[model samples]
Target: MTEIQAGLTVCTVLVVPYIVQAIKTKAMTGNVARWIAISVSTLCGVLTAMAGGMPTDASAWVTSIFAAVGGVQVAYAAFRSVGVTDKWLDALLALGDIKED
Candidate 1:
């Protein structure tokens, strides 16, 4: 896989669980730590994307990808720590839930 895609995959694997927990519990408090982690991960992803250039360089690509993962983890933890319920966070968590149709 390409560097970008690989980075995203790593992030997704790391972040999805916290999101699920937040939605299932509906208690932001429970995910404070995770939100912080995913936030960092997301931030790293953005930075890497902004940095541009080839991802083939093992060192750069690895560091970028690791940062992306950490950012995502931070994001999730931060989202929970915010201690407020909003439509957006709710919607995000709901994405993984069973849609009652």
Candidate 2:
């Protein structure tokens, strides 16, 4: 196989399992399908970065970046749905709340 093709294959092998596992885990609630979509979207981000670096294609540079941004949006939403909050934010929210209310 060509170098670029080989590289893309390797990257796909590495990313697909992560996406599968993220969907397999049931730690989060809400829509399971949405989590699967998020995982694929994140994979698209990986694809975008890889595609962006190809020397043969100039269009990939622009298109891949947009795909990456969409992936980022999905990933952020996934994190938010899973309760993956920042410590500072949690602390700030706690300050305005009561222990027993």
Candidate 3:
């Protein structure tokens, strides 16, 4: 993988789950967390594909998402041993004018 791809892979694989859990504790549900994982994995894969210099098109994005699903998304239960949720996420959402449901 290219440096960008490798780096993004690390962030998606290692850091995203922590953020997701933080969101969960911020009141996002298990279903929300699951979808968040899917969304982040898809984003990582698309960026990975772009970094890898694959075609900058939907087909390539789809291919990359499938491929990266194995490496990018760490299981929620596998790493849910700690709770790191915080108020930072609330501030982040507020910046976007998003209110919790």
Candidate 4:
């Protein structure tokens, strides 16, 4: 496969499992490490896509979309872990059923 295709495939393989696990766990309190790791990974993906001379057509789009989603997930998890709950926070936190510790 082409380089973009390969990169996209690798990103998918790495990200999908974490997304699935986050959804399956339904609790982000104890998963801070994982969330942090995912956040960093997504950030790296964003940087790499910007700098690695990769194609921006479809692979960039997919990576950006997933990275945004994962970033939001990580932010929500962090907020939930801090026990800050409001309507918006609740909605975001509710995505993973994260509870305050």
Which of 2 and 3 is the better model by lDDT? 3
Select the stronger candidate by lDDT from 1 and 3: 3
**Which candidate ranks first by lDDT, i.e. highest?**
3
Task: Tell me the deviation in Å of residue 28 in model 3.
Answer: 2.0
Q: Tens digit of lDDT per residue, candidate 1, span 61-98?
A: 66665666754555545655774334555676669899
What range of 10 consecutive residues in model 2 has the weakest lDDT sum? Answer: 16-25
lDDT comparing candidate 2 with the true structure: 0.49
What is the Cα-based lDDT of residue 48 in candidate 3? 78
**Candidate number achieving the greatest TM-score relative to the actual structure:** 3
Ranking by lDDT: 3, 1, 4, 2
Q: Across residues 14-87, which tens digit of lDDT does each residue of candidate 4 receive?
A: 45444434454345554664555566556655655655465558767566646554655655455456654334
Candidates 2 and 4: which is better by TM-score? 2
Model 3 residue pairs with clashes: none
At residue 28, candidate 3 shows an lDDT of 73
Per-residue CA lDDT of candidate 2, range 1-101, in tens? 34553455445444443344444435755466455545665556446556535445655544444454454454445555665433434554469777785
Q: How many clashing pairs per prediction, in order?
A: 26, 0, 0, 0
Error of 3 at 50 (Å): 0.5
